[model samples]
Target chain A: MAFQIVINLIIACMWMFLNESYTFASFVAGYLWGILLLFLLNRFIPDTFYLRRVGKVIKLIFLFIRELVLSNIEIVKLVYKRQPQFEPGIFMLPLDLKSNWEITLLANLITLTPGTLSVAIAHDNSHIFIHAMHIDDIDESIRSIKDTFEKAIMEVTR
Target chain B: MIETGIDITLNISVSLFILIGTFFVLSSSLGIARFPDIYTRLHAATKASTLGISSMLIGTFLFLYAEHDIVSGKLLLAIVFILLTAPVSGHMISRAAHKSGVKPVTANRSDAYEDALQKHRKNS
Candidate 1:
């Protein structure tokens, strides 16, 4: 990750030189260009896992954004309804990913979304505690996270 | 005239983003006030407010870019910082709340932590 960031910065600088603008847009564009370039050059790199998963990463981001927007709308409705009904609960989520980075990213993504927040991780890293605002079925939420968020992350990390 | 046309479009879009962002923030505030417990309130403050501030910053970024052609890396930095720190802080706060003996209003059937704590107490 650190090496990738350095490469991204170097690409951004090169982009500044090419564009001669030295602006933020150019830098972001350059960073994206760097990512794309690295992605293309993944065959030669030793760590092919992360570079190859760029598409999955982008998909994960889009999924998060869509969920974020939908959740925001739900929260708005919840706040406006005459008698708000929130069945908030915290449940222990058994995790599949073992790495620290994967766990952290999963937790962060959960916390960022609309109704759920990741509270803590087990000492053994086997499970995470999540608090959800409208959990009708714990099994369903767990399956959803595992299928979408956790599955997407596994594509990147594993 | 052509420049004015572009300006008007930018203005409208920026305003729209701002409006959406403000709406989220307002809902979050309502959530904070109406929610019964600390855990739920944390949910409101962290998730909704983070999105709200982020959307507003996005509007600011768009306006500045449209008007001045300045790429404010600072605003991007701020957004990244908020995105990274906000959830971590929320986790810490909620963890603290739990550890300090605050209970969730409607917890599910099982708690791994409670079981672990009991076993440790029995051993000690």
Candidate 2:
């Protein structure tokens, strides 16, 4: 991804020099041209186009923000309830992520969203122990994590 | 600075964001005191505090950008750093707690981690 971005920027600068136009608009035009050129040349490249990854990253950020706000509201409601009745438990979530950074990001995202806090991970990195504030159903919590944050993370990384 | 319409809008929104941030922070503190166990407390401490600080920093970024026409990189950097580090720190704390055998207060359903540890021990 970084290589593609650098190549694109270099192409844009080359375009500007060739056109003898130094304005921001010309730079943008050159960038567009570079994008088209790169798209056409993508068959020779090893990885997918960089913009697809960028879009996925943006989507992950938005998804995280939405989850954060929704979870915060749920927490607020739980906090203010008179005589709150909820069951908190520690359960293991099986991992599908392979790399260190991806697992770390998954843990961080899980901690920052909703009622779940990542307590520990197995030595082999096969599972993460999560402490959820409200555990009405274990499978439901696991499914939610797998479907939302885990799925989004897989999209971003792999 | 004259109280122009844009200025008024900016001021109001900035203050509003700050106010919302403060509320979340306060509620998080409440959660910390009111929760039963270390693990539950971590949930409150990590999530709410992160959201609170990010919102406040975003407000500050907006205010500076609009009022002074100065793009504050430091504010934006601070927000990103907080978001990144807060969860890691929270994870570390909880991991330590678990390693130290700080059990959840009301875990009735199942503790798969403990089960896994037992299985590993038996296999070894």
Candidate 3:
């Protein structure tokens, strides 16, 4: 991925030098041209094209933002309630993610989204403990996490 | 600084965003005061505060761009940095609290971490 980015940037710079135009527009055009060139030559590359990963990353960001907004609204409602009655508990989440960074990212996203905070991880990286402000049904909450954030993360990383 | 129609519109929107941000931040503080346990308090402190600060920063960014025609990269960077770091800090605090055996106020359901720890000890 780094090599591909370096090649694209070099192409962009060479295009700017060749055209004698050091403007942002020319650089963007050159970048687009580089993308097209790379797309055409993608078959020869061993790994998947970098733009696909970039697109997946953008999708993950949108997914996160959507979750954040929805949960924030929920938090607002909970905050203003006259008599708040909710079950807050700690539960285990068995992780599908491997690697320290992936687990860290998952933990961060869970905490950032309102209502759920990741508390700790198992020594073998098999499970994460989460403390949620409201868990109507433990199984349901676990499934939602698996479906939304976990699925989106797996799509991006794997 | 100009009193153009667009400038007025921008000013209104900026104020609107800041107002919303302040409301969330205030409610989050209320949450911290009212919540019974450390874990519940963390939910309020981390999530609401994050959205509140991000909204305020965005409003500031828009205001600067509209009034001065200068995009402030620093404000944008600050928003990103907060979004990135707030969760880590929240996680660290919660983990520390749990490790030190600070039980939650109302855990109607099972405490999985404590169960796991007991199971680990038995195995060892």
**All models, DockQ values?**
0.55, 0.69, 0.73
Task: Return the lDDT, model 3, position A28.
Answer: 95
Q: After superposition, how far is residue A85 of candidate 1 from its true place, in Å?
A: 1.0
How high is each candidate's interface RMSD, in Å? Answer: 1.9, 1.4, 1.3
- Candidate 2 segments exceeding 4 Å error: A1-3, A19-29, A40-46, B1-3, B121-124
Estimate, for each residue in A1-158, the C-alpha lDDT of model 2 and write its tens digit.
88888989999999899999899998999899999999999999778899998899999999878988888888888878889776887788889999999999998888877788887889999989888776767688799889988898999887
Clashing pairs in 2: none
The residue-by-residue lDDT of candidate 3 on A1-158, one tens digit each, is 88999989998999999999999999999999999999999998668799999998999888777877777787788889989776888888999999898899899888866578898999999999998776667677788888888888888888
Model 1 chain A weakest 10-residue run by lDDT: A45-54
Greater TM-score among 1 and 2 belongs to 2
TM-score of chain B of 3: 0.92
DockQ score of the complex predicted as candidate 2:
0.69
Please list, in the order the candidates appear, how each scores on TM-score for chain B only. Answer: 0.89, 0.90, 0.92
What CAPRI-style quality would you assign to candidate 1? medium
Candidate 3: regions farther than 4 A off: B1-3
Off by over 4 Å in 1: A1-51, B107-112
lDDT per residue as tens, model 2, B48-111: 8888988999899999889789999999899889989988999899878876887667657566
Q: Considering only N, C-alpha and C atoms within 3 Å, which residue pairs clash in candidate 3?
A: none
